[model samples]
Target: MTKSLIDILDLSTGEIDELIETANRIIENPQAYAHKCEGKKLATLFFEPSTRTRLSFEAAMYELGGHVLGFSEAASSSASKGESVSDTVRVVSGYADIIAMRHPKEGAPMVASMKSLVPVINAGDGGHNHPTQTLTDLLTIRRKMGRLDHLTVGLCGDLKFGRTVHSLIGALSRYEGIRFVLISPQELTIPDYIREEVLEDGHQDYVETTDLEAVMPELDILYMTRVQRERFFNEADYIRLKDSYILTREKLDSAKKDMCILHPLPRVNEISVDVDEDSRAGYFDQALYGKYIRMALILKLLGVE
Candidate 1:
């Protein structure tokens, strides 16, 4: 059977841990795995604009000595000519051993997976899921905090449409003693489905509030996200909420010295620039981990590991 990573739920707890371990090994010994995917090809079909995810996937394949070919935007692909995702994947699967797709539609990758002969990895989908980013978050937490369990993770900013936050919450809930402090505006609260299905179903402990400062002192990890302007329906609404949550160095005065601060990157003003110099700021290191973890995922899917 072929495997595809369309959602974080597609991977079991054990599999995620195994991938993390593989990623760590790759980081420690880069030379040993340089040619692991030699002679393989990866196709990146990004129907949406991306900097970190797209480049990280390309870099991951290159590090494993695999070749990459694909488009960065929908305009550059046959989709611009009204080609369907299924048709796109069906065509690309013949050219590549594996496919990484990022689309604006929620289930675009899932639809592609149904038609793809090769492994299909979802780089991201329209505010729906970003499983790879979840893996990156888990690896970052494990490496920085020394464990995935027994942590109070504070998710600040736009939780409603932040796919990274949604995926991270689902992934972390599988562990023991994982608590969530959801900090966002009332309009930007986590969707009811996630609250009901993930947190409530798992019997996880979580608190919801619009206050980031109040929750700052209790968090073991602070996961920040930008209020995505693209996800907003109204320009006025986006303008109003964009500056609602900004993490400053002053806010860290109440936080634990070891509390790791993470952001999914391409951050607007949600995170103040002064926080970048702090030792606890792990977003940059988190980006580096995205490359390594993605390498593990590519290897796993391509049967190279």
Candidate 2:
């Protein structure tokens, strides 16, 4: 049977640690892993527009000595011609060794994985899940903090529809002493399913607040997220909450000097540019780590490790 990554929960904590270990190896020595995927092809079927995820997937394949071929947006694909996701993925499976897909609809990749003949990676499915991003987040956290357990993780911004936030919480909940500080406007608080199913049921320590500054001092990792305009049904509501938590240097004073500041990029004023120079800012390095972790994932899914 072929392996697919549609949700972060699909991967065990041990598997995550292995992937991080592999990623660190790739980081320390890139040439040794080059050509691991030689002659294999990765087809990226993105139904939505993206810069980081898509490019990183492509870069991952390329760095591993593989080829890439796919459309970047729906308009560029047969989806623009009324093609179903299952049909698109089924067809692409014949042409490529693997597929990494992103769609605007939640569970579309799950639908694709069912029909795909090859392994399927869900890049992002609406605001439901982004397993690879969650992987990247995990690797970033493990590298920066030197451990995944016994720390407070501050997730701020649009948590209600933030798939990265949802996936990260689910993954981290498996670790010991994982406390979550959820900061977002009341309208953009985390989904109840996450709060109930993941946090409450797992007995994870957490607190919900709209205030970012008040909880800064306690966080070991501050994962900032953008208030996605695309996830909002109402523009006015998006406009109101978009500026909810901008991390400035002054705010960093309250945070631990060793605290790691992470953000899933393409910022929309949720993070101040001045914070980029701070030693705590790991978001940029976080983006770079995405490539290496993705390289490990591609190798894993391909059975080429």
- What is the C-alpha lDDT profile of model 1 across 1-305, one tens digit per residue? 47999999899999999999999999999999999989999999999899999999999999999999999999999999999999999999999999999999999999989899999999999878899999999999999999999999999988998889999998889899999999987878999999999999889999999888888889999999887678777899888777668888998999999999999898778889999999999999999999999999998998775
Write down the lDDT that model 2 would get.
Answer: 0.92
Each prediction's RMSD over C-alphas, in Å, is 1.9, 2.0
> Residue 28 in candidate 1 has what lDDT?
98
The lDDT for every candidate, in the order shown, is 0.93, 0.92
The candidate 1 region of ten consecutive residues with least summed lDDT is 237-246
Backbone clash count, each prediction separately: 0, 0
lDDT for predicted candidate 1 compared with the true structure: 0.93
lDDT tens per residue, model 2, 1-305: 47899999889899999899999999999999997999999999989999999999999999999999999999999999999998898899999999999999999999988999999999999878899999999999999999999999999998887878888999999999999999998878988988899999999999999889899999999999887678778899877766558888988899999999999888878789999999999999999999999999999998887
Q: Model 2 TM-score?
A: 0.95
Candidate 1: RMSD to truth? 1.9
Highest lDDT: give the candidate number.
1
